[model samples]
Target: MDRVKGKTAIVTGGATGLGFAIARRLEQEGAKVIITDVDVTRGKEAAGEIGGLFKQQDVASENQWISLIEQVRGEFGKLDILVNNAGISGPVQNADPESTSTDDWERIHKVNGLGVFLGCKHAIDLMRQSGGGSIINMSSIAALVATPFITAYGSSKAGVAQFTRSVALYCAQSGSKIRCNSVHPGQIRTEMHDSLLDETAELMGASRDDVENDFKSRIPMGYFGEPVEIANMVLFLASDEARYITGGKFIVDGGMELGG
Candidate 1:
């Protein structure tokens, strides 16, 4: 149960869905977790529920990232794990490449792409001071496949995957024990997923159930994934059990990326 005992972790967007599950899992396994989110109320509630701490943060802000890392350093004396899980899918109307506005594209990339980059960058600095640690960036199946409907999100996530590899190799070359990897989840049953379904249904003029069923049919597993499933993977990566693993892209996508 103490897989990450005495470790210190920071999970972004931990107020809900996948982030909350990941934070809870890490804390349950004995890590001292700090949950961060733009949603201050829910963030505090979530932290309270998990017996962790809460910090309000807008991940896209470099200043916030700097402050967060410093706070972690001050409170915990060291940071061991970081889950860059905060992101946005963008408005469904302008998500397509052809219709997406420059501002829309930049907004998605700001949070999904730049946020992870900053997290890895600052976390590396802190982690190096205290030996080394693990950095888990949450990507998505959209990153690995064609996502014409969510061009910005897919592109940003793709950037995350490639960047993770670069961070891992860079750390390894620099003789830093820090490990970096990306986790790509497919059709997880989260609020984000629900929003996607609702939007898709509206776009297609179909019932939500119909849209959901259609999506389910494409997944080889024939169902959406659970948050705990992804959390378990993060736990393993966060633990010393995966000490040898670095620069890897772990896909937890119920075989949906294998093609329908």
Candidate 2:
């Protein structure tokens, strides 16, 4: 808990799933966390549970980010960590690569890729003024491997990986104290996965349980990862424990891409 003592953090999409888990872990580590999510109800609940503040903000919206960062700066004085965890696999219609349209590509790029860019853009300035901070971007194993159906998602996450490195070097070149890193998780058990499993099951005319196991079979771990595992990694990166680490890509996959 002393690792992040006296620190303040902003976690986007922190209402549930991996984001919420990360928020909880940061709070446990003695950081005052502000959870931003589009779902006001869950966001408030999560913040209350974590003893943090809740703000409704869609990460894909640049104007919303401006207001959000301003509010965090005013209330918290300085931001120590920023987690760009909010994202989608793309709209339902465009989830399939063959069916993906230009508009779909653009939308996913805006949320999954551009959102990280904007977060780093605004947070780096604040972190610089405050001396330094850590930025953790939520990528996916798909970014490093083939994703036939989720082509847009895979592409967006690939952009995230490169953008993370670019921003990390930019900070280093500018002598800013901010550190940038990326994390990739494989098939975590979240609502997002549940929905995907349901969709795949329907398409395959199979039970959700059967489809879930089929998905798990591909993982060397023989099970889907829990959100808290990913959260734990984020906590480590966001805390002083990772002071010497920067510009790194940490994979939390359960050996899902072992040979790849």
Candidate 3:
């Protein structure tokens, strides 16, 4: 539990769901936590709950990322962890790969792909100057499998996976202690997944129950996972327990990959 004690961390989209859980876990483990999100009201409340700081941020913007890194370094005196958890599932109606528009692609990549790029691009500088740190990027199982439904989502996540590896190699070659890794989660029951189920049901003209069952059937465990499961994996990566880990694709999917 004290694995991350005295560390400083930032969790994007930490106003709720998995991000909030990750933030809470780190803070509980003795880290200085800062939760960032565009949702001002909920983000502030969530940060207050854990006695952490809240910053309004749109992750896709380079300027905001610069400001965030500066602010965190200014207030905390150093940087240690950066969890690029802010992302979007793309437009629900555009779930069909064939019908997905360029607009939807832009929407998904801007946040899910470019946002992470910016996070790492900026965070690495700060981390390098302050003795290096951990960077955890939230990818998804969709990137590992054949996902025709959420094309944009899967593509963006795939970029994240590769980007993570590239960053890790750069740091190692440059003689820095900074570690970059991607976390691939499958069907975690967060607000994002819940909304995805609803959207799929509406698109298919089926009940939510039917859609949920179909989705769960693919999992070898025959069940969806909890947000905390993903959070725990992130925590492990953020801690010294995973010091030897870098550029690794950590999948916390309840054996779903096995089913495939």
Candidate 4:
């Protein structure tokens, strides 16, 4: 208990799925958490249940990001953890570069790419003032591999990975106590996965069961990871125990990315 006692955290898109899991785990470990999501209903409920605060936020907007940080300072006095987890997988249409419309690319990049950049850039100021904090960016295995069907998604996540490394280096060079890292989760069982599976099935003209099995078979563990499993990694990074770790890419993929 109290693994992150007295810490203050802001988890963008914390209303559901992996974001909710991260928020809940942070709360359980004694962080005073503020969960933000565009989904007001669910975000408020989740925050209330965990004894935290909820705010409607659109991470894609620079204006919203500015206001959120200011509000966090006014309410919490100091920010300790910033989890940039808000993102979209982009439309799964024909997703190859040619089939991917400019609209799809722009929309996904705004949230998944630029939003993360804004988060890291702004949060670093507050974290430095707090005498250093952790920045956990939600990257994905998609960033490390090619998935033409998820062209926009993979590209945005790649930006995240590189951004994470750049932030970590900046902190280290400046002799700051701040640490930055990225978490790459693969095939986690969540609404997002369900949607991805459904889309893949439709795209491939395969049964949903067949699509799911194909995904599972790609994992050495042959199963989808639970939300909490990914959350635990965030918890560790948020804790002081990971003081020595930074600029790291922690892949939680059940060896799916491993070569045979």
Candidate 5:
């Protein structure tokens, strides 16, 4: 864990949920961390609790990315890790391809797809100067399996997977020490889950308990994964421990992706 001591990292959407968990893990591993998110209140609270810096950033905004990297460079001097974790599920119940509007699709793509692209695009420059870095793009199980209900969500994640691979190869071909990888997670209990639970229950015409049970049953582990578990995987990849790993997709879904 001390391998990351004195290293600097940035976790996007680090205010809460999986992002916050990753930030805390990176800090615990001795990395000087900065977390960015649009949620000012929660972002500041999480940063204060973790003893890291928090900045307001809308991942979908291309213009802000330049400023963001500059800010990090000025304060931290170098960037060793970049976690592209800020994403939205996109208009929940209406996420079906046919049912989804152009606006919804564009918005989701902006954050989930373009955001990761821009993050890596800017990060590589700073990282190359520092000799090397790791980029972890947060994908979802939806990227691999077809989730009939949330079309936009699935499409955006699919884009993330490919983008991660493309960047990895680019870095390799360029002879840069930087690495890029994607982490696909299954359902984890978070505020985002709370927002969808009732609606999802209604959509499936099942009780909330039944929906929760159904999700758990899908995982061979018989339980939902903790965000920290995913965080641990990311921490390893961001550290020298995974120096030889790149362009790989790590699925932390507890066997949910086994069947279909």
Candidate 6:
């Protein structure tokens, strides 16, 4: 309760799944949250539910990023936290390096890679004006491991992880109090995960249950993770309790990354 009281936060892709959960958590902890997503209707509904604000945004657009930060500055007078959670995995098939087309690769990178970069870039400027803040970029286990099936998404997330470190170092070296870190979630039970399951099932000509079981078997924990679990980590990072933590990679992956 009140972990981030009086703070102002912007959560990208907050209309659903992990994003929505993160926004709700921040709002619940007393932050003034703004939920941004391309899905205007859902985004508004989500914001209303959480007693926060909503902004329609295509994160890939630099103009929109600029406008969003300006809006935050005008309304809140300062921005304290940013969760760069918006990203796209694209179609499961044709995602491999050999099968992926240039268009498909670029599309995934545009949203997953460039979006986070832009968010961090603009958020830093606003945060620096207001005595600095925390930036949490959502990476994934795919970034840590080889994801031959999702080459573009995996590569984009890997870029996010590395870029987060760079952002943290730059802010620190420049004497900015801003902190940057990446959160990598593994097999979270979200709509995106369900969709991936369905697609993988089809691609492998296997039953959904079999595909799901196969995925579960890969995890040492033997189950999917919940959204709130990831949200809690973000909350911790957003709070002053983690003031000394920067340029870190927090893996909330249920030990899946350890690889049984």
Cα lDDT of all candidates, in order? Answer: 0.94, 0.89, 0.92, 0.92, 0.91, 0.95
- lDDT of model 6, residue 178: 98
- Let me know the TM-score candidate 1 reaches against the reference structure: 0.99
Question: Model 5: per-residue lDDT, tens digit, 122-203?
Answer: 8899999888999999999999999777798899999999999999999999988999999999878888876677788987
lDDT top scorer = 6
TM-score for each predicted model, relative to the true structure: 0.99, 0.96, 0.98, 0.98, 0.97, 0.99
lDDT tens string, model 6, 1-260? 99999999999999999999999999989999999999999999999999999999999999999999999999999999999999998899988889999999999999999999999988998899989899999999999989678899999999999999999999999988999999999999999999999999999999999999999999998999999999999999999999999999999988988993
Give per-residue CA lDDT, model 4, range 1-260, as digits (tens): 89999999999999999999999999999999999999999999999989999999999888999999999988877889999999999767768988998889899999998989999888888888898999999999998878768899999999999999999999989977899999999989989999999988988899999999988898998899999999999999989999999999999999888832
What shift in Å separates residue 63 of candidate 2 from its native position after superposition?
1.5
Q: Could you give candidate 2's per-residue lDDT for residues 198-242 as a string of tens digits?
A: 878887798988998888889898888899999999999998889
Q: 1-260 in candidate 3: lDDT tens per residue?
A: 68899999999999998899999989988889999999999999999999999999999999999999999888887888999999999767856778999988898999999999999999988888879889999999988987668889999999999999999999989977999999999999989899999999999999999999999999988899988888889989999888889999999887888877
| Stronger candidate by TM-score (2 vs 3) | 3
> Which stretches of candidate 2 lie above 4 Å from their native place?
91-94
Q: State, as a TM-score between 0 and 1, how close model 2 is to the true structure.
A: 0.96
After TM-score superposition, what is the CA distance of residue 244 in candidate 1 from its true location, in Å?
A: 0.2
- Give the Å error, residue 112, model 6: 0.7
The candidate with the higher TM-score, 3 or 6, is 6
Give the worst 10-residue stretch by lDDT in candidate 5.
89-98
Global Cα RMSD, each model: 0.8, 1.3, 1.0, 1.0, 1.0, 0.7
